[model samples]
Target: MRKTMLPVFTVIFFALGWALFSLSNTTVSQIQPRTLTLATTTSTVDSGLLDRLNPVFEEKFNAQVHMLSLGTGAALRTAENGDADVVLVHARSAEDAFIEAGFGINRRDVMFNDFIVVGPSNDPANIHNLESASEAFTRIAQTQSLFVSRGDQSGTHQKEQVVWATANINPQGNWHLSVGQGMGNTLLQSSELGAYTISDRGTWLALKDRLNLEVLIEGPVKGGDLILLNPYGVIAVNPAHHSDRDYELAMAYIGFLTSIEAQQMIDDFRIDDEPLFFADALNEQPNFEQYVPQSR
Candidate 1:
């Protein structure tokens, strides 16, 4: 009986050792080099900009960027979850708070486009050449225009909220419809419904051909709410949050995204020969970058 028990114990020990060795081999196989995960806002992806931008980075760096584009809030949540190696987003307040909290490091300002109030050709709100985004909203409110809001808690939506605040309008009643859709779909809905709306200029340009809506009013010209400035930024996700985080790839992507060549691509990318985003990442950015740097 003792010999039989001894043999069974040895067999079990060998099986456990084999299992451990197999797991170790599997772990080694899973290890990857020069790979990154990035969480970003939908605008960067939806406008088909990434489709143009990422290939260059991949070729140059010999790295892979697994990008996840969600709303600003959801993007930030990815960083918080240690699921992303980097982040590219538009919410300055949230990004600042993220860096301050040590969840993000090495932030660099990237490109930008202003928001626009778009509506049907009928000009229901009659908000063309308004000059001030706030004033345009005031006009829209007073005129009771049919406004379709993305209402998806995205960076664009955040800017819209600020514009409404500037307009000193709460925005209640029949003229408003919250679609809670992505940028492209929202544009389609606004076009199909012939409703007025506020949207990022990049998105508008990207989808302008398929949609009937035209620019009703330009939000903020340069920086102020008048410019209704929309900026994109890249930040390294703090590695402390995830031990296996790909900091090397994240840093590479940051360097690539903020590189002069990348900025030039941004400057050069256009729809129908019209510039969509003005690059603001390198030595010379738009005026907004001067005001908001990595520190403040």
Candidate 2:
């Protein structure tokens, strides 16, 4: 009995030491506090853009910019509620409204990738050759082609709203289906259903290899009458909302986003030989510092 008791006691001591070792490691990990939460859209997150960008940004900033990827609506809500330090989203109208509501500041157009209507390879809606996005929607509405909607108040959904408004049509009856999810999931659903759907060019491009759908209509080409121009923007939350948030840090990130290095990164952010986004930080308005710094 004494021998057994002694061996059991020795085992307990070894277990205690191992527990302390793990505890010390966890405590060490918690000491740095090198984390920042970025609320951003699903398209960017789902396409693993953040993963590609994070290493550079984190090494430069000496901190991790962990992302909470959601739809634009959900991300804005997170920013508004002070649940995140910064937000990267694309919906222009909603973003303007958010800033006007005193929830955000420093709106900077980071980059752009337009929305597109995708359908099965067969093109059952007969919208294959339509030059006008609105006309395509009108025809789809008329024919009642199965249309998959993100359904969530996402940037893609907002664009769809505008397109529907332009076509003077309402997505009613059995014609439209709302997936109420992120871009990747919705694309999968659209593929499975072989339906027509509007999606961000970035997400679609990233998932192109995996999906059987093809782009049916391109939104608002340059010099076109289309209203759906999907320009992504980065915004810092109002300091008044969360005094504890590192406002300066958020600003610095915005600065990086608009900087020449980051613009170059954005310009190079491509997949499968198709550029996911066009850096518009300097294209719309010529800022020498944005595209070409004085040092360069």
Candidate 3:
């Protein structure tokens, strides 16, 4: 009986050892890289900034960054729905509204590139060199010169709406073409139609060589107009709202964006010796309360 018991115990020990080894192998094999999802505007993707920036973060952290390039409104909605970990967008009013609704937290200013109006080289609307974007829109409408509108609720579209509102012109007609497209497509369409459209300077600079369109109205950065000042912000989706959201990773991403290294990368990113985005993360201390919506 003792001999039989010894063999049984040996078999049991071997089985347990094999089981533990198998479990260890399974765990090691199943290890996956951390993934962080970011929803941002198309302008960022179009300007190729992410292409230049994302790889550095991924390699340093051993994580993968999945980016969804949508319109600013759509990107915010994506984060609100818990589909994205964070957002990088330019529309301050919308970003404030999102935070006010409790869908986001830890909002930080990232970078900025002003918006510009571009049109045909011939300058049919005679809006070239205009100091006011509103006045430029007014001329386009008055002449009924074809104007391409993004129509989609993008940040660029929101700025366009503001300019139209400031001009006090209810633009509607065959001449006002609302394409409901992304910035790159809108610029292409504007070029195809020889029409006027508003574009972010970064994208305009990146893709200008491909399109027939030329910058006709500069934003404040180039001393064109104050209303065209376009600032961008990065916001992490509130983990309180969505417990599954990778809030820690999102904050890390935001940290990397505002870090000295990333900010310098943004400053150094250029097209044809012209910096597309001005780094404001370190230098600017904007009124935070101004962007945060007050409870009524």
Candidate 4:
């Protein structure tokens, strides 16, 4: 009876020690910072800019960044639903709408990259050397050339619509293909179909090697074409809408992104020695109020 009792006591002591160890570990884990959810556009993720920048943010803050890469519209929707802590998108009009709707706050300019019309190397629509994007779109529609549209309502898609409106052409027919996909997929589709599509310069440069398309129109060609200026902004999801949002972490991320170090990193990001995104946080911030609709 004494020996049996001795073994039982030893087992109970070990079990109690194990339970205390687990409890302590759980307490530590619970006290540790949680992950940050960032809903951003696909261009940033697909172009590998986030991959290059997120690690520094994570390390500095001791928190993991869970990226929900989607179109600017979808990303804003996610933030509106209180599913994301922050967002990085490019469509100025849409961003203005979001801010006015009270879904986001602290909008800041992060970077700028122009949009370009890319198509087959042969230039079927004879759009090559065309200074105006609207003229190029008109030509594409007039010729009924295969033109791919990212019907996903992404930032790129929004810009495409603006160009179409500028051209005064409601593109339709079999020639205008609305693929309802992201920039990378749309670009791939365009390449496969040998069609024309609009793409941000950064994504194009990053994925150009794998694609057969060539840039049909680019900016600074001795004429003013500000229509292609694609600027990216970072906005924190309003915590008032979602009580669980990690507002502090989101602001930390914003600071990290807008910091001088991160700005330099943005300027340094390149593909094949050519810079991808130009740093704009240090420069003049865009007056998005002008883009805001009067109805708001």
Query: What TM-score do all the candidates reach, one by one?
Result: 0.81, 0.84, 0.86, 0.84
List runs of model 2 lying over 4 Å from the truth: 1-33, 220-226, 283-296
Clashing pairs for model 2 are none
* lDDT of each residue in 61-172, candidate 1, tens digit only: 7666788989887898888889888999887777877888888887888887788878899886677766788888888888887788888778888788887887789988
Kindly indicate the candidate among 1 and 4 with the higher lDDT.
4
lDDT per model, in order?
0.80, 0.82, 0.89, 0.88
Task: Rank by lDDT, highest first.
Answer: 3, 4, 2, 1
Model 1 global lDDT (CA atoms, 0 to 1): 0.80
Candidate 4 lDDT by residue in tens digits, 112-153: 888998999998899997889999999999989999999988
lDDT of 3 by residue, 243-273 (tens): 9998999999999998999999999998889
Candidate 1: residue 176 lDDT (0-100): 79
Q: In terms of TM-score, which candidate is strongest?
A: 3
lDDT (10s digit) by residue, model 2, range 181-293:
88888999999899989888778887888998998777653333356578888889889978877787788788888788888988887688667777778665554432221
TM-score of 2: 0.84
Which pairs clash inside model 4? none
Q: Give RMSD (Å) of candidate 1 vs. truth.
A: 8.1
**Runs with alpha carbons beyond 4 Å of true place in candidate 4:** 1-31, 220-224, 284-296
Candidate 3 residue-wise lDDT at 42: 93
lDDT of 2 at 122: 87
Q: Which segments of model 3 are wrong by more than 4 Å?
A: 1-31, 284-291, 294-296
